[model samples]
Target chain A: MDNMEDNIKCVTCTAPVNIAVIKYWGKRDEELVLPVNSSVSVTLDQAQLRAKTTVMASPSFPNDRMWLNGKEQSMDSKRIQNLLNEIKQWRKEKHNGDTCTDGLLMWKVHICSENNFPTAAGLASSAAGYACLAYSLAKLYNVEGDLSAIARRGSGSACRSMYGGFVEWDMGSQEDGSDSVSRQIASENHWPELRVLLLVVSDQQKSMGSTEGMQATLKTSQLMDRRIQCVPESVEKIKEAILKKDFKTFAEITMKDSNQFHAVCLDSCPPIFYLTDVSKQIIQLVHAFNSSCGITKVAYTFDAGPNACLYLLEEDVGRVLSLICHFFPPDKDDLNTFVQGLQTPSISPLKVLLWT
Target chain B: MDNMEDNIKCVTCTAPVNIAVIKYWGKRDEELVLPVNSSVSVTLDQAQLRAKTTVMASPSFPNDRMWLNGKEQSMDSKRIQNLLNEIKQWRKEKHNGDTCTDGLLMWKVHICSENNFPTAAGLASSAAGYACLAYSLAKLYNVEGDLSAIARRGSGSACRSMYGGFVEWDMGSQEDGSDSVSRQIASENHWPELRVLLLVVSDQQKSMGSTEGMQATLKTSQLMDRRIQCVPESVEKIKEAILKKDFKTFAEITMKDSNQFHAVCLDSCPPIFYLTDVSKQIIQLVHAFNSSCGITKVAYTFDAGPNACLYLLEEDVGRVLSLICHFFPPDKDDLNTFVQGLQTPSISPLKVLLWT
Candidate 1:
C-alpha cells in the first residue's frame, strides 16, 4: 500500500447487443432515459456482436478520461457526466469495508471501449458500449448490485443489454425513474434453438441520432401515444410467447412492433425514413416467404438505421438463409455493400418453389 | 323511336384531380365505400390534370361496356356495377314527367374515360376518372342533384373530386352511406395564388390499389383508430385554413395528414411502402426548404404512389421549382427517369443560399 503510484486496479468486461421484440420508441422522461412502455428483447452472444471495455483506476491518474472506438469522446455531455458521477458516488456507498480512509474511491479512472464488429449501423452499439462501461467500472470498484439502472442512464435500451438472454425494461410509473429498471425474463439458454441474423448496410443519409429523433417523435408523431398504449400489453404477450417458446407468436409481434416504431417515425412532422430500398426488399422477402410457408417462418426488425435484424427458428434457418441468398445474393463476402435501384428482387416466383 | 339505332343520346364531361390535405385511409364500410372519418381536399384545375369521359346510350350497343385510357376494362367489379346501377336508378326516379317506357334507361351504354396527365402516380387519377364517369352519366340522363355520392361508389376519394377548389367528404354517420357525400368548401377562385406541382415518380413495386390498401390498414394498423378520431377535427381546421387563406396552417396540416396516411400504411401487417427513396428525397427537400425559410412556404403530400404533390404559394413556386430542378434535375425534358443510388441530394448547403 506504500507504493501508491503503482496502485492500478483494472477490469475488462464485454457486453452484447439486444434486439427488441417489443420496441422502445418515445421516452416519457428524457433526462432519466425512461421509455414510453415496457419492452422485450433477445441478447446476442458477445462473440457475435459486442462492445469490450477496459476500465483502469490509479492514484497516478490526474482526471477522468474516456475513449470510444479509439477516438476521444466528449465527457461534457449531460448524460455521460451524470453516468460517471453516479458511478463514482455508488462506488463509495456500495463498498462494505470499514477502512478509515478508502483512498481508491477518490481516484480518477481511464476508460477505453471498442466494438469488435465493423458493420455498426443501428446495431445498438451504444447499448453494448454503455452496459460494458457500467459492468467494467462496477467490477473495478468491487461493487455488487443492479447495474441495469446505471446502464439505463447512458441509453434507454442499454439497460436491456445489462443481462444476458431474454430481458425487459418495464416502463415504471414513477417521478424519479427509480422503478424504471430492466429485468431478465429468461436465460440465454432458455430458447436455445432461436437465432438472429444481422444484415448491415451503410446509410447515405445521417439520420437524427436516437436522442433527438425520440424527442421529435414525442413532440410530433400522432401515433406515439397509441404506440405507448399498445406496447405494455405487447410486452406481456411477447413474454408469454418467450416462456412458451412460441416462435410464431414471438416473430409476428416483433415484426409488428418494428413496423409500428418506424411508422411513427414517418408520422413525425418532418418525417423520418430509416429503411432503405434494400431494407424494404428484405422486409418484402420475409413477408412473402412467411406467406408462402403458410406460417410465420421468419421475422424482420429494423432499428434507427437501415440494417435489418432477422429472427427465425433453427429448423427454418437453412431454408430462409438459402432463400435470402438466392434473392439478395451478396455482392461482397462481408455483406457490406451500397444498394441501388428499385428493382425489387421479386421473390414471388421463387416464393412458392424454394421454401419447400 | 322506330329507328332506335340512330336515336342515341350522348354526353361528355371532364373532372379534376383532388389532393387530400386531410386524408381518408380506413373504410368503415368497405363495400359501401364509407370512410371511417371526414376528409378535405384541394381540387386542381382540369387543365393541369383531368379525366375526360364520354358516355353514350344506344340500342346498337348489345351490352354495357367501359374503356379506360383507350383500353377495354371489365364492367364486372361490384363497385363499378354499383355506380352504374345507382345512376340508372336515379335517372328513372328523377324524370319529372315520363311515360311508363322511357326506353333510354334500358339502352346499354358505352363509356370511355381518359386522363390527360401521364405522371399519374399518386395524382388521384382514379378520383378524377370516377368523378368524370358519374358527371357524364348524370348529364346523359338529365338527372342532376348531387353526383358526389354516386362517385363515392366508385372510389372513396372520387367523391372529393366532384366539386371544384376546396372540397370536403363529410363521413356522415349512416349505415347505408346515404349522408356520406362530398361538399364544396370554397370555389375554384377562393385561393388563386395557391399552386401544386406534381412530381411523378414511377414505382418499381406495384402497390396494392387504394381499396385493398385501405382494407389492410383498417385491419392491421394500431394508428388507424387514432387517425379516425383525429381527422374529423383536422377537417374543421383545414376548412378554416382554406377560408382564411392561411397557407401556413394549411401546409402544416396537409403535410401531417399525408405523413400520417403513409404512417398507417407502413404500420399495416406485412407493411405497404408507397414512398421510394426518390419520393423521400423530395419530402426531405420540402421540409428543408420550409425550415430554411423560417416560415412555412411549402408543403408536400403523397397518396398510394411514389409521386409527390407539393403545395406552395404562386409567389414561392419559382424558387421551390428551381431548387427541385437544380437538385433533382430532369435527365429528360419530360422528367421520367429511373433513379439509382442512395445519393441524398443534400439540400442543406443550398437550403440557406437559394431560398434567400
Candidate 2:
C-alpha cells in the first residue's frame, strides 16, 4: 500500500543484449526458461542501438498502465502482469515513509518502452527491450534478488543482458531454476578496442519467432539432442577464446556456432527457413572479402533474420570498414551520411572525410 | 601372338553413386584425388536409374576412339584416357602378343553415354557413369590391375561403383593413393527388402558444380578444416549405425551430416546455394510427417541440387510414398510419355490400371 506520489519516482533505463555464437537450444524446463546447458554471449555497445524504458508509479493514478514500443498493451497478460504485481508488493512492504498512506491499496504504474532500431528486424530488439524493462524495473523498485535471476523471468536470453559485457548463462540443474543465472565473463572495459560493424540487411519481422521455432526443433529435429549436448563444450571454448583475445579461435567458434544454430533451424520439424538470399550473400561476401585481404579471422554472426553483425579487431577496423563500405556501397544519397555517422574521435579524420 | 580380335571384346557398363549423409569436403591432394578422411555412401540400383555407356571396336575403324554421352571427345582432355592407354599397353605386354601391330591399334572404339536420371541433380550420376565406363572398359580390354584401383583414377567415388552394394572409400594417408581404395561395407543382398524413393523435385542442372564449390570451400571456409577432421568420427558412427541396421541412428547421422554439408556450402567463400524452396519444403514435410507419426527417424539426403532421395524403412515405404505423392501431386496434363516412362514398377502397374 502506498500514497506513491511522494514515495515513487519515475526512472528510465536502457540496455542492449548480444547474440550468442554458441546458441542456446534445448530447455531443461520450458516454463522456467531454464536451458539444458550453459551458454555464452557478447554484449554489444548501447550507444547507437538500445531499448529505452520509463517506469512511473503514483498513488494518484487509477491502475497499471503499460506501453510497449509506443503501443498501449494489456497488463492482463499473465507473465508481464505477474512481474508487475510482484514489484508492487515488494515496494509496498519495503516502504515505511509517511508518503505511503495506511489505507492505500495500490500504486498505479505506467511503463513506456521503445527501441532505437526496428523491432521487426531479426536483430533481437525484443530480447534487448524485455531485458532492459526487467533491469530498469528492478532498479526502480529496489528488488533484492540477483539481476540475472530476475531477468531470466523476462526472457531466457534476458539473463545475459544484465551485465554490460561478455556474459554466460549457466543452465543449472535446480528444478526451481534458482541456480540458473548469468555471470559476467568479461566486461566491456576489457575489450574497449573491439568494434562491431552491423550490416542491417532486412528490417522485416521473421516468419517464425525464436521461441516457437526452438520448440519445434526440440520436438522434430533428430539433431537437437546432439546440439544440446554440444553447447556446454562450445561455451567453454568460446569463453577461453574471448578471454585470450584469440580472434582466430573466436572467429572459428563463432562461425561454427552460428552455422550450428541455423542447422538446428533447418533440422526443425517442418524446417524453419530463416536465412534469405540476402543473408546468404552477406555471409558469402564477408568470407570472400576477408580471404581476399588475407584476414584470417573476422567474425560475422547472423540471428533469425538477414542482418549481419561483423566483429573486427581494433587494428583492422578501418580497413575492414572501408572494404565493407566499398563492397556494400549505400545508395548514393545515403553514402555521405552513412560515412559521416561512422566517424569517431580516434579514427583518422582524414579517412572519414575522404569517404564523404 | 599376332591375332588381336580374340583378345579384345566390346563392352559397356554404368553405375550410380550415392551422396553421403556425412559429406566429404576437403582433399588431401588434388592431383591424386585423395580425401583427407574416409567417406561412406549408398549405391543406387542400376535397373531403376544409372549411366548408360556403349563401347564398340572394329578392325575397319581407325585409332582408338572414345565418345562421352553423345558427343565425340578427345582422349587427351580426359585423364582417364591416359589411364586407359596405360592399361592397354600393360595388356599388350602381359600377353606377349603383337596385337598392337595386328591392326588392333588401327581399330577404333566408339563410346556413348547417357543418364536415365538428371545429371548433377544430387544423384551422383557422374560418379556412376565414369565408374561403369571404366569398369566396362577394363572388362573389354581385359586390363590386368585391380578394377577398384583403375576406377579410382577415373573418379574418387568411381571406385565405389565397382561393387554393387554399400561401399566405404578409405581415405588412406599414402601419398601415392595406393591404399586409398573402396571396399564393400554391405551387399545389396544384405538389405534386399530396403527401398529408396527418389523425389525428382527439379531435373535442372545445379547452378554451382560440386567440384567448383568444393574448391571454393577448401580455399576459404574456416569450417572446412573442422569438417574434414570431424568426418572420420561421423563415418565410424554411420558405419556402425548401418551395420547394426539402426534406422534411428542412421537417420540422425544422415540428417546431421547433410545439414553440416550445406552449412559448409554456406560457409564457402562465394557461398554455394544448392537447395530450392521445393527441396526445403520436402525436408520440412519429412520432419513434420515423421514427428507427427511419432517416428524418430527417416533418412533423406540431397546432393548438389534440390532433388531429394529419401531412404524409408521397408515397413514405412508404402506410407511414405503415398504421403509424398499426395503432397506433391503430379500434374495430369503435363504427364508426357517420358515422365510416365520413368515411373517405378510398383507405381507404374497401378498407373496403367488406373488409366485403363
- The prediction achieving the highest DockQ against the true structure is 1
Give the whole-model CA lDDT for all candidates, comma-separated: 0.80, 0.68
Per-candidate interface DockQ score: 0.77, 0.17
Superposed Cα deviation of residue B192, candidate 2 (Å): 11
Our tally of clashes for model 1 stands at: 0
- Candidate 1 residue spans exceeding 4 A from truth: A1-5, A95-101, A119-122, A203-206, A332-356, B1-5, B95-101, B119-122, B203-205, B332-356
TM-score of candidate 1 versus the correct structure, residues matched by position: 0.91
Per-residue C-alpha lDDT of model 2 across residues A58-137, encoded as one tens digit per residue: 77778888898789998886656655655555556667643554343355778899987656544687667767778777
lDDT, residue B64, candidate 1: 94
User: Model 1, range A156-272, lDDT digits (tens) per residue?
Assistant: 899999988899988888888888999999999898878776666553444778888888999998888998888888888889999999989999999999999999999998898
lDDT string, candidate 1, B168-244, tens digits: 99999989899999999999998988877776666344568887888899899888899887887788988999999
Record all residue pairs in model 1 with backbone atoms less than 3 Å apart, i.e. clashing: none
Candidate 1 share of real interface contacts = 0.89
The top-ranked prediction according to TM-score is 1
Instruction: Kindly report the interface RMSD of candidate 1, rounded to 1 decimal.
Output: 0.6
